[model samples]
Target: MDTQTQIIEQIAPYQPWLTLCGVLVLFLLLRATRRALRRRVDEIGYWLLGERGRLIWFWINAPGVMLHELSHAAVVLLFTPFGFRITSITLFRVQSTTARDRYGRVVRSGGRQSLQLGEVQYVRPQGKLISYVGDGLSGIAPLFGGTAMFAFLYWIATGYNLWDIPLDAHQNWQLLRPDWPWWTLIFAPYLILTVTSELWPSRQDWTGARWFMVGLCTCLLLALGLLWYTNHLARVLSLSTFMASRIDFALVVLVVLDLLFLIIAELTARGVRH
Candidate 1:
């Protein structure tokens, strides 16, 4: 085989992982961009509606916040010690914390001064706190829940199958149509904003989950190594053809659309300010 052909063959098995990483990088970039533009967006929102607009926006997105906290609460209730005797639950905690660096210095370089955070609190089963994985699951319950919520909302807003979008990016996008009522056009934005904002977990959310993430990556590497060692690489590679392909396609659709809208909003805000 030619060098290029041999290279392609070697990478074929790991293509899914590499593509996933690329998507993650892009996701982070877009997240940071949205954050950077947030201050300006808020300013514009206030300018347009005065002092009450911020409050109005906050209440408008309250459903998303409620959904986010409820997701966490549900997980806690699910893993109840005896399946029903729950002791404590906090649906939401919103606070503002000053930004600081890794060494504890105030991070004044960033445009903003502090961060507004929302949290969901709940008690774990008495003896079930031994595993970091459990904490990890609890911490990130919103992400899984938020993704599912977004899929549902996306389906409602566009009437497309979330897990069945066309792999060919150009295809079917033009055919998109929302079968829902006209009022959806008003409420859908708030719902979508809530879902998207809640999708990115905060630093506190990753504290216990970091080790669990490390364990997952370690296991993934080991599993792939074992597959290669056992001459089952081809089978593992075929996983991309299964449900993964559908999920990836759906995510691509979501992320691209998010980037497009965010960029447009940022530009429009800048234009209005100038």
Candidate 2:
């Protein structure tokens, strides 16, 4: 066997687990980048505009906020047959409001009202089975939605379709320097910045689906364990690897965008301080 084949053979048994760990690391990196970027944005806004800087921050990230809410609304609509109903969608919040949980119970954080930049309200299903699946899917909609939007915007800005592109880091880096239309050069950065800023699901977004997610993961682990015991996991290794590759590609794109914007934010903040 060739060296590449030898390596694959050695690692084949662990590929799925390795891929999972790799994706998790990428997510952590994305999260760190987002927090740093947000902090920089906040600093710049406060330094230059005072309290009103919050408005500036919102406007700059308005596209992302809208996209995030829309993702929730879309998934909720998809689960309409399961009794999901979209009651209200708010793109921007100019006023404070009382917070409520997924079960409509009052939520108090240090006895203070909540501030929501954007929101999507949906009625939950009464059936436990459908509710679990619906809530889990709805909670993760932004991740799928943002990835799709980011890929689309990337294609528009650079004439490179992320789906079609190979996952070679050096070649992909070169593709980033595509000859751009003047308009794209001026506008793409802002659009990308806004979209990526809100790409990750918030704590509230994950709250409704946490238990469901845990159960789903547990089921998956049991299934995988059963397959391994039967020595049948190899039968599905190709499919798993295929799905893992696509997911890794999407995560890589998100992480790269997050890093680019984070660097821009950091540099901008430094300049502002000076």
Candidate 3:
């Protein structure tokens, strides 16, 4: 009868297959997306930061970079029992002079490496084994930290939380305007964009968390399979009431916005190159 009900009935039979196919497609697409996003970040960094040991470029993004590094350290501190000590946090690097390896080959003498950006070095007690989940979360803390930063800025600018941001873009314009401090309108978006762009953990960060993510993904697939077999998947995912929920809407909006921005950035960078 109803359009929603008709759609649900049509999809009910293929729920499990759809789930599997969706997962497979997403897996492939996500890898491509990440690569494109990273490439764009590199391009933008090069264009804005410039080639060479440019100290000014690093200084421009220093605040975001510092917060990004600190976030990694914060996770260890938050875990309580983990009791890891943060050894060092490098914000940016000075000009690195040319160096040689054993064969006296030239290395990355200058550029992004020279800027250093930021790093959080940490260490745990000897022989103290950290669980995979803990290791993974600690490495991914910058993602959480960046989200928190966005939320905080949203509150400061609009006197409300990010979740309060209306789904309608036209209605959300007021959130950009501050009643007192006008400069926040300019700075907030720029800071958020910088921090958000860096939210993706580096390859080294994933090295520690790779298996953990794999395990989680496996478990999730199992659960999804079970739900599909029981024919509850569609109902659970399509709950009409949940569709209108603010928090649910906020999470979806945030994810969509992130992906959309990344795709746009990638296209823009490619266009500039051409």
Most lDDT-accurate candidate:
2
Candidate 3 error regions (>4 Å): 1-57, 94-115, 125-129, 165-183, 239-274
lDDT of 3 at 242: 41
Show the colliding residue pairs in model 2: none
Better of 1 and 2 by lDDT: 2
Model 1, backbone clash pairs (residues 3+ apart or across chains), number: 0
lDDT of 2 by residue, 1-274 (tens): 7999999999988887788677778878877877777778889998899976756666788888889989988999988887889999997665676777888898878965456788888888676788888888888788888878887887777776765654355554444544556566467767876887777788887896797789989999999999999999987776776777667776777677777877888889889999
Winner on TM-score between 2 and 3 is 2
lDDT of 2: 0.78
* Candidate 1 minimal-lDDT segment of 10 residues: 82-91
Candidate that would win on TM-score? 2
TM per prediction:
0.69, 0.75, 0.58
TM-score of 3: 0.58
Q: Tell how far residue 119 is off in model 3, in angstroms.
A: 1.8
lDDT for each residue of candidate 1 in 33-131, tens digit (9 for 90 to 100): 556545555766776777544444345456666777677666666666534333555444444577665567766746643535355554444444344
